[model samples]
Target: MRADRLVSLVLLLRQRGRLSAATLARELEVSTRTVLRDIEALSAAGVPVYAERGRHGGFALLPGFQTELTGLNHDEALALLVAGSRRGAQVFGLGSALASAMLKVVDALPESYRNTAAGAAQRLLIDPETDLLARRSVAEEVPDTIVAEVRRAVFAGHKLRIRYAAADQAPKWRTVDPIGLVTARDQGYLLATRSGADRTYRLSRISAAQELAEPAQRPERVDLDRAWQERSARFRTGGDQVTVSVRVDPARRAHLVDTALTIGAEEPEVDGWLRLEAVFQDPRHAEWAVWQLATHAEVLAPQWLRASLRERATTLATRYDVPPGESRPSRASAAATSAATRTPDSTAPSK
Candidate 1:
């Protein structure tokens, strides 16, 4: 514990350049008396530690103090370099600064390890062979500055004031005690607590964020990742569960149940008869599922769903300027329609 404290204290001094005795004591989990004693030990050893009092307060070290680092193997050095590179310029806030710090670390390393790391960095190529990466399709981009602020508050166990936009209302400012930030497949989510309820806000919907001066203690019992995972799973599977029955062409039904094909619900029914059933959370989401089965599958149950499907069909016809009694688009035409509804990649946030 003494060694750990000493290491942390030295690193903290390096990071802050100066710190008050009270601040150092609190950060190092030691008494102010112990911090003063440690400072004495460092100074007695010619470590260049200095102290100042009164209005201009705290302790500082003279510039150009160099600490020695030793005893790391080639593999360990390579791993450290790789980790440093990934964390350096790859993320927001402290990333670029951290990366610059890593260059100093590499420069300080022994020649053998430095050459090994530099060689690895040069030999390794991370570029993609094909341009298969589709552009990001997030609804709105979350700004890096807001993300940095949220991260700071979350890590510091502080509350944050955020301007958040909800689906049914204008953007409103709220104070949230941030627990963590999460990035899902196509979105970023912030898990926080407000008014005694755990909530998740889409990062893109957060127009602005600022740290609150009030520091609220976080609950030690809360596991943010576990809580968010459970919440997200429920959202995916907990919608109104329904089983819809449909009859369609057996050939088309096989394809619907197997390959991906988009055809009219009636077309498959007209071609070859096939019967099927599936579950859904919402009637609309389920209807869309059945609509995908179109030409191959027909809605057999819950007359309301059947009626709703007809209304949807009518609406589609109107939108496309198709006359009544005219057949809807084929699978190829529908593919283009689906593509049109997709959000553009340009809307996503930058790396």
Candidate 2:
């Protein structure tokens, strides 16, 4: 830890030129005494660190002294900086570590590339709270201790015991052998197995976690990417997957697949519409996705899904009190019906 702090301190000096002892202490979250000792240690090790007297002065690397972190070109340094700017690392409790690492990378770059890399990275934006369309993609928060425990079990090939608050279920204790950890957006997941059954636990939902003493019952060598893909495929195809064959208008055909759990085979009909075999999360999911598209999308099969949609539509139709046998009107139909229902006298001034 001291070595990490010392490296971070050097990077700060390399990036900002000279910095005061108090500044170093504040940046490193250490004391001025520690900073002084590190400076002395650097000098003893022939690192060319020197102190300057007077209020405007502090510790600095001698002119032209730069750490040799080579084989990295300008683009690589910029990429590293931009990546460091993201909060994905923060979700796993690596925010401070990422910052320190980024500092070392920038400091190690060749002098000619360092400033350009820094400036170029500052121009790119990622994962802003509100995106370009002003829509907030809210982030999930996980406790530091929970993620640290989960990460430890994953990387160290150990089992983990967790108190998890599963969605729609009461909090319960579970012991699992962690396979890997995955982060998407700002949320993290623990991909693990219990009794050889694959399970995924959202890291944020873990109220408490502890690394188990027993070694994990897992393969010695794992291809995490392959394991994740296999788990995902199983999850998508095995869960309460509902298949809904649908006839969707051309305009809504693309939209249908956008919201589906899986898009199966599709065929274009002679009527200019496409009949698609769409897989949805469940009946409720099928109903919700189709209903949003209204008459533009029609559920054609898997009687249960069709029935569910019809039930909701019938209820919706009743809510509006349209005469029985009068079909629900879409936007265009409603406009035409509105015109047909009115008389010329209705628009004329009364005598």
Candidate 3:
């Protein structure tokens, strides 16, 4: 811990120039006497650190001594410097500081190296396609100020009063003890609880949130990342998992084996196609997933999924009203019908 403190003290001095001994001691959780000893050790090692004795007394490095920049080779230096010019640099206020540091490095370079480094810098470019602000907008619907307040509540274990909006539901006011903020696609989600029930609310949908003066009692520690992963796994499992057999087109079958979803044994099918056996969690996820290889896959098992897909296909077919005489169904064939509404001429059997 003392070594850690010493390293921190040196880095702080390098970055901030000076700091009061009392302040350093408080920061390192050590006594002023130890801080003085640490300063002495730094000075003894040719660190050029010194202490002033009176009203403005603090530890500082002797004027004009900067760390030599010889540690980094040309490519490494170029990468580090170019990273600061990337699109998100403004988010951390690093552009100007990086430029200044790069200049110092250039000034310290031998004349021979100076030209080469400049040419390498010109060849390298860091262009950020997405600005930090735009990327941040995808994570949460709310502004930075609101996220700040929510973070404070989460970290402090405080109960918050929030006005929330849900999809197609009337806005409701509620009190919840915030557990943590979840980030998805650059938006912030508040995962919290009210009366022992957990809920998720988009930060964008929150309005007029305020933290209470008194903090609520909570577990000493909560692992938010673990909770998110477990919940995602469970949600995937929520849908029925059915054993299925499908015939896939030759062109689309390879993509099947390459995907993350389970694919069972394959067997020869008609017209040189292949039949695949698999189990999928949700029909909804399956539908979307298979759509990616639309012409390539044909569902063959459990009957219900095939029926569902057929119904969905019928609906889509009716939308375009395929002409009756053509290879497709008549345009009106897409019209939705069921046992309750089917005419006698309709081939759809009555229940």
Winning candidate number (TM-score): 2
Measured by lDDT, the strongest candidate is 2
TM-score (C-alpha) between model 1 and the true structure: 0.47
All candidates in order of TM-score, best leading:
2, 1, 3
What's the residue-level lDDT of 67 in candidate 2?
69
Assess the local accuracy of residue 22 in candidate 3 as a C-alpha lDDT between 0 and 100: 88
The whole-model lDDT of each prediction reads: 0.67, 0.80, 0.66
Off by over 4 Å in 1: 1-140, 237-284, 292-297, 314-351
lDDT of 3 by residue, 1-351 (tens): 354456556655654567999888876557999999998887887788887778877998766676653343332343354454332222222333343344455656776886788789789755434566664332223554565577678868899888888866878888888887665544457778778777777877887688887776566688988877876676545656655677888887777666425776877876899888765666665666566676678877768777888777877766567566556534455344444486676776778
After superposing candidate 2 on the true structure, give the runs of residues whose Cα lies further than 4 Å from its correct spot: 1-10, 17-85, 123-131, 269-271, 300-351
lDDT of 3 at 270: 61
Candidate 3's C-alpha lDDT?
0.66
lDDT tens digits by residue: candidate 1, 1-351: 354455456656754678999998987657999998888877887778888878758888787666663233332343354353342223223333343344446656665786688778778855322336865333345566887788778867889999999866899999998877665544567888788777889877888999987885568567767888887766656756666667766656564554222223332334457555655656666777778765456677889889988877867765678776788777678779979998879979988
In model 3, where do residues sit more than 4 Å from their true spots? Answer: 1-140, 165-171, 194-199, 205-208, 239-245, 249-283, 302-304, 315-351
How well is each residue in 173-290 modelled by candidate 2, as lDDT tens digits? 9899998877666777888889998888888889999999899888887787787788778777776778888899998878888889788898999999999989987767788899
- The alpha-carbon deviation from the true structure for residue 282 of candidate 2, after best TM-score superposition, in angstroms, is 1.4
TM-score of each: 0.47, 0.67, 0.46
